[model samples]
Target: MLGTRVSAFLKLSKRDLKYDLPASIVVFLVALPLCLGIAMASGAPLFAGVLTGVIGGIVVASISGSALSVSGPAAGLTVIVLGAIQQLGAYETFLLAVVLAGVIQLVLGVLKAGMIGNYFPSSVILGMLAAIGITIILKQIPLAFGMTETHAFEVEDGGGIAAFTNTIFSSINWGATIICLLSLAVLIFWPSFKKLSKIPAPLIVVILGVALGFAFQGTSFALNPDHFVSIPVVSSFAEFKGLFIFPDFTQIVSKDVWVVAFTIAIIASLETLLSIEAVDKIDPFKRNSPTNRELIAQGIGNMSSGLLGGLPLTSVIVRSSANANSGGRTRQSAILHGIWLLVALLAIPTVINLIPLAGLAAILLHTGFKLAKPALFKQIYKKGLDQFIPFFITVAAVVFTDLLTGVGIGIVVATFYILKANMTNAYQFNIVQKEEADMAVLTLAEEVTFLNKAPIQQKLYNLPKGVKSVVIDGHKSKFIDKDVIDVIKDFEQNALSKGLSIELNDVTYKQKPLNGNFRLKKQKLQKVV
Candidate 1:
């Protein structure tokens, strides 16, 4: 009987609703606190975060090609959003920045710049993940300890880390702390069987947290108002309509507006692209998402979010990973999560407020551990120094500075190693000194750039001064920069004076010297002994 009902439902749902329905509920639970927390951290209205969640679910997921990635406002963007909000001085003015950011992202997609995502070094991306993880763990520590008045403003100059550190330890509530610790225990130690996960650990955390809140009521261990989630209550649809604030076009001319817009667009796009790459690696189905289309979908979502008075949105890895872990099988799971958020707002605003902030903190703390797991470092170290240095530097820089700045520093470090590799191993040099046939074979790398010039020149200079024959081989090379080729030609012209006969094999010469009428004295091609 049940089998027949399931079959009929599967036929009605294209066989996806079964997987998507429960997963959507799980994603909604995961997104709820994150959305509220991010909004609080960004200094935006609480409702704005929820609104972004809806758009990311319904709008971005509907258009995105990714099967598992969930779009919403990200913790990674919190610092930037915080600074932008303070500078703009008005939520509506900040909304203008958000709208402009969406436009810029749309232009980036139109220009086919999604391929830019491919250029980021793995070391840098890993560094970003680690840095954000560390930030989350540290930022949530106080909240988990039941220390209210904890905010995520940057540990900036004149204020430094001390000021931020002092703020967290001032007011401590034992009840919130106990609930948080117990909630983390459940999430961490609960049976992780595939069937067991259907009852998401986070949902359990919220339930327990709310029960704790009520159980300790009228006691010394009672939860503080600051320690609980608070959602605004609206009496009617018109009052709900009054909550949204639109963008201010009048501020569009301001340079700060444009600057913040560009900053948000670039960082948001980079984060989105990185998240897409990260999610694809973990996907059980091994599907690849079209990066360009993701940017376009995100752009549209951000535009809608801005117009609706919400924070900027991106494809967040945290929510997406949760969805995947919860057995979400389609994009329908993500879209349905948004619908859940919308439905909850219209029906259960009071119920949401009963969720403890501590419970949400526990969920994020678990996420933080996953992001910067100790095993990740051990794995990167096994790859050796050429990979580890850039990865470590990226992590340190991101933790100390911001994401964009850390990535910049990491890319520079990665580039240095690349240049060093080119300089040291640009080509292989071998000397064959058979009686009467003394030949030096120079085999160029597949792609020899100008960075390889110095080493190639040095090898040529160090060649046996009395060798009678030399072979500069490019048979395996796909590209040889003009400067490198010029060095070879220059050495060829200069070699004849030392009683050396030259043979150039499979070389593509490109330059002004090669362009003008030029003829080689000998047309011999050399073969390796």
Candidate 2:
């Protein structure tokens, strides 16, 4: 009986692992450099990136709703992290913020705020993605030129042009620069080489760069070792001892910690939600992800990351998209990707150390270019100015300011545009009831939200002065927000003075008022009805 059970379990595991193993390996190849780069960007220890990858894969993957989406430390948080570290006064304090942030995320998931992600317009999503791509490209330029530590303007920092100019004026690492250019050339032209067309270009570039590093190690032709990958040197478990740094619980009482904690939670939630939405759109199977479940998975992953002295993790689109494009079809791919990080960090640190920073930069640069491609802008333009304007604004704002700030600006602008567009064709108040009739019937459209409140309020206020009954026909309305319900409550109170009776038709109040009024209470959707 024991052997039978063991055999059954093994078969199940094998069945689940088969196709995803190869894809997971591919994803691992892509995730490693990104993990290192993002960790460096976030002002965290290099191993923090590996920790995030592991937790995201082995822990988060076990609970995440997404089948293909991968989570880990993100480059998007680089500026936030740098600022947090500076403000918090110590890495340990910042880690406390991370832990608190995870707790906040867990609360959000419990409250099911994940539905908020559904409200963001597709245009804004596309624009944000494009901006991220541009930022990646701009940020990688210095590394591509083997100019780490040389401050340059980056797209994310809104210094792309300035950075490019500065790099041009500085002394160049000609050998590393040549390799970067050559790698780009091969990536662009390798498809022409019929036999090599199917090869993963980035892997090839990395291999070549590493080989060159070894070949020229002892000669005048050698590139500076500092420009190469810098995995921490460890001889034993004790040497790897300080890799995990716990958060300082002493900061738990500080207001600043709470502030940073909430900020991290809100931003991380937004990023994760957006990433999940985007990943779902790209999923070939078109399976929708459970947003709340994703939030929970992220919360757990981040909590673990924070507890272990690692940076926060989120559903990063770049890595997730890379995994999907590489043919990953299951959670095992994500889990395996994490396993690769562990193996590389522990067993192959020397080989990783040989990879040139310039090569990795080249990979990021290529990715960035793909994101900011002119074709995407043209496509947005074709969708109409409503789409193009918001997208452009989002890109510009994100590039000039910061991620959250940029998104806020975009949301405000998009809201105004939406209001303006809706106002023109909003509810038309046509009285269907005759003067002799006791009831005045008003039919609402397919949907109504706070934006329609003004028009609705105006229609209710101007009700023919003598109508005995006011019937709101919401049978056609699919959904109504609390603001509109509040307007209705106010209308109900005033209806007594106007000698009119207000009645809701085919509409059940989804929420109850806090004070026994008709005001809609905040509640979760229990069913479609």
Question: What would the per-residue lDDT of candidate 2 be over residues 318-356, giving only the tens digit for each residue?
Answer: 777766665667777887888887888888888778888
> TM-score for every candidate vs. truth?
0.85, 0.75
Please state every model's RMSD to the true fold in angstroms. 5.5, 7.8
Candidate 2, which segments miss by more than 4 Å at Cα?
A: 1-19, 151-170, 189-199, 215-221, 427-529
lDDT of 2 at 451: 78
RMSD of 2: 7.8
Residue 7 CA displacement from its true place in model 1, Å: 18
After superposition, the stretches of candidate 1 with alpha carbons farther than 4 Å from their true spots are 1-16, 82-89, 150-171, 192-197, 250-256, 433-439, 463-469, 500-502, 511-529
Tens-digit lDDT string for candidate 1 (258-283)? 99999999999998998887777668
CA lDDT scores, all candidates in order: 0.84, 0.77
TM-score of 1: 0.85
